[model samples]
Target: MVDDVADVAELGVLTASAAEWSVAVRRAEVIGRLAQEPRVRIAEADEAATQLGISRRQVYELLKRWRAGSQVASDLLPRRSTGGRGRGRLPEEVEALLLEVIRSRYLTRQRRTVSAVYEEVVRQCRTRGLAVPSRGTLERRIGRLDPVASVTARQGADAARALRSAGGEPPVVEGLLEQVQIDHTVVDLEIVDERYRRPIGRPYVTVAIDVASHCVVGLVVILEPPSALSVGLCLAHMATDKRPWLERLGVEAAWPMSGKPREIFTDNAPEFTSEALQRGCDQDGIKQSYRPPGQPHFGGIIERLIGTMMEMVHELPGTTFSNPAERGGYDSQASAVLTLAELNKWLALAVAVYHGQVHGTLKQTPAGRWEQGVAEGGRPATVSSETAFLVDFLPAERRTLTRTGFTLDHVQYYCDALKPWIARRRQLEKIVLRRDPRDISRVWALDPDGDSYLPVPYRTMSRPPISLWEQRAAVARLRELGRDQVNETALFAMVEQMRQITEDAAARTRRARREVERRSATPVTRRTPQDPAPLPPAAAQDPAEGEPVRPFEVIEQW
Candidate 1:
């Protein structure tokens, strides 16, 4: 039983302190059984309550949480500060004050000591009648700040530049697809929405580079922040033929570099180190390698490649530039024209151009080097189906098959594919499932008899597809309205309302911004009024729009 408990805790399903994990495991054992029951009887509830040493009412509440949380062990994990390493204990106003003070004082050229900063923070907090954060809390917060940014702000730009070096020697790799390095950053440009052509926000770009040939193995641009989903998408982009993606972009270009890498080198980010990523790599016989915690140069290849890509983006409209000094007196959003799709297309072309350019270190075009590497290593293996390959890398869940179907977060999934599994449900304990958070309308369940996965769609097919975030938001909204029991209909209705509100808000925001820009414009002189009123300055168009630019950077290296 002890060994079993340890094994359960190691499954990565629940991350918490030891005591918290033990409680979670015990609760999962009880609640997981209750959730799977065709019908929970009073006797069963009494027994579970006694086992967990909790009230019968609390047992029912736990059962509800377990069922609604996709039957994961984490659903039962303690939520308070004592239970897990989560929950921001500080008040919102206090937290805001801490951040403001830290940014305005600590991260400056003055280079105040942590002790001095803490003293100042305490004085200000007291003056504002707010709870002061402990010294350790402030220190930890400072540690979590962007390292390069912190260094640059305190030490100097040159000192920060030194930290980016991979040390004295570069890592050595053997052949094609031997080592792939990936990293992501917010693109230095604002992109517009397709519907309104108004600047929505900057998107993140994740890039992967093959170490041996220095060829970009994969790239994905998304409006969302870096997460397991984005990482999986980027990896999928890297490990498949780029020609299909390029074709979809309708751009004529050659991007033949494609295949699964022997190993991946990434930064020590939570998303990069997720259990899903590790399991996926294990299943595909791929190795996982993290950049050394103190070494910045180990990830230099991908960083430099990303740097080049951002430079290319700098040439596009609405570029915020590398820093505020570079963007002096410029209004990025005012000139923004490209939509997300258009920016993606533009990036596709930029990548095509970059691939043909000769690398300073390799002394050969990335594409040419890739061809040579293929000649030497005889082409790396790649997956035929991107979705099938990606399913393993997606977030994992476990659910018991019911007669009707598998219900998760109040949504039931069913299909003919699950009919056989449903019949033999008693034979199996719980089957593992994988879900793409972007779309929760369907999930892939692992087959008990075989290694194949079966796609399970929503039992109510007419239910509009919604993201995991949308579902959670809808649930929260329902809870706020004192509607504890949320049905599929109610949840989706709330989602629709939320989406409509967002659309209306975005329209209003765009109109307001345009009006502000018009009002804030510099007045033309009277002399210009006499000279044909300067023809209204031709509307200050973005050159990237209304025309396609040839790749002046592309090198002829056939």
Candidate 2:
């Protein structure tokens, strides 16, 4: 029985302390059963004995003591002698010595182990002519120290601070889409440009996941890093129907989930903390909750979802995998075959697969779980329109309205709506310019009444619809070509010409390198009639020796 008890303790099924609690609860229940049936105490004692697997007399004695007005549970539970650790075994002076040594030497960034501290404690005991406690006693003392202090000693202040809130289990979100998490991670696969096929770089993917259903509601794959624009675009994708977008990519599946989430949980990224995002949330009646700073585990839901998607990406041809060891000798850049557009389509398909496949945690496909949630009366919230979402969530900047029209980043913008404000500066007035980071060809100027935005087009029609990245690249290229200022027509025209030139060059190179085989061609092993006779080594003099030496006469100079 003693060995069995030790084994149980080792297996963590039951401990000495836990067993004592179990006995105390049983004692209380048995006592309560007897008290209600005083006349049938003997019969009750028999039943209780059988149920508890103890002798009947023991139950009787327990009831007798309970009837005598003692705390039955407390008296039954195990207690140390004199309510303390084996009293008088280790001197108080010696315990204090050990604690002081641990606090001063062990509980620090130096990471002094308990064994080292114990050895030092022995030395201190000898110096003080004190009795040395056993090693177990010293270890127990160390274990009893405050957990925060212990972590601080072993790790550092940051880890110790994190430990404060890391102790509890994650909060339970009750309903599907009741809370959603959003985060961004750079996809670990290299991609190339669609036209030039030159290696661009790894693209960032911002994903929003339903916390309850574990469904990936929306994602944006772009060459840009995490930014407010990406966050807003991700939210727009979440709140709007995705079927059209998926269909554009030739993805044949159903993405029936889309709605404005009630609450959004995010980390302390600047994009999440940006003023535009906060204002949009407030305007849309969505509550935004930021995870505590320095505690990334709080946003584990979205992070894990991103990780899951990246794992799927790893199966592709040019994946970077997760680490150098996993990648080994794989040439990610040279092996890259997918362009950004192709990658986006693949991501859409992967998301479809993710939704269809059963999740280990949800025990159901995310799509199935989402359908179930909707069937059980879970309705998704939605925005007015995609245009409204973009206008509301896009970042805003301040610029002064001028007669030449509002210029931003060295580009001028004008529209019929801006005619009234031209050369007329309202008192203390600055036009609020809202530009979409994805598209810089246009911007919206807020009306003075703040009722609507006035669309402002680029000053030149030659500047076709282009993204911020393209615009920047064009400007950089012009600068490289020694241009001090950008001529809108000339700059954009040059960009288009360069793109055309590259495409034509690639086409020509491919065409010129094409191999052609003629049906009449044959090997000369049998000396075909059309084949010329091989020249002798001496007769085939090097071309540089001018073997056929034409006669020439030197002209006399006057």
Model 2, runs deviating above 4 Å: 1-101, 112-136, 146-148, 157-167, 190-202, 274-279, 285-295, 328-339, 375-377, 419-424, 474-558
Q: How far off is residue 101 in model 2, in Å? A: 4.5
**Off by more than 4 A, model 1:** 1-171, 510-558
What Cα-based lDDT does every candidate model obtain?
0.74, 0.68
Candidate 1's TM-score reads 0.62
Compute each candidate's TM-score over C-alphas: 0.62, 0.66
Residues forming the 10-long window of minimal summed lDDT in candidate 1? 529-538
Which RMSD does model 2 reach against the true structure? 22.4
- Residue pairs clashing in model 1 are 165-297, 166-297
Give candidate 1's total backbone clashes: 2
Worst 10 residues of 2 by lDDT: 515-524
* Residue 165 Cα positional deviation in candidate 1, in Å, after optimal superposition: 7.8
lDDT of 1 at 403: 95
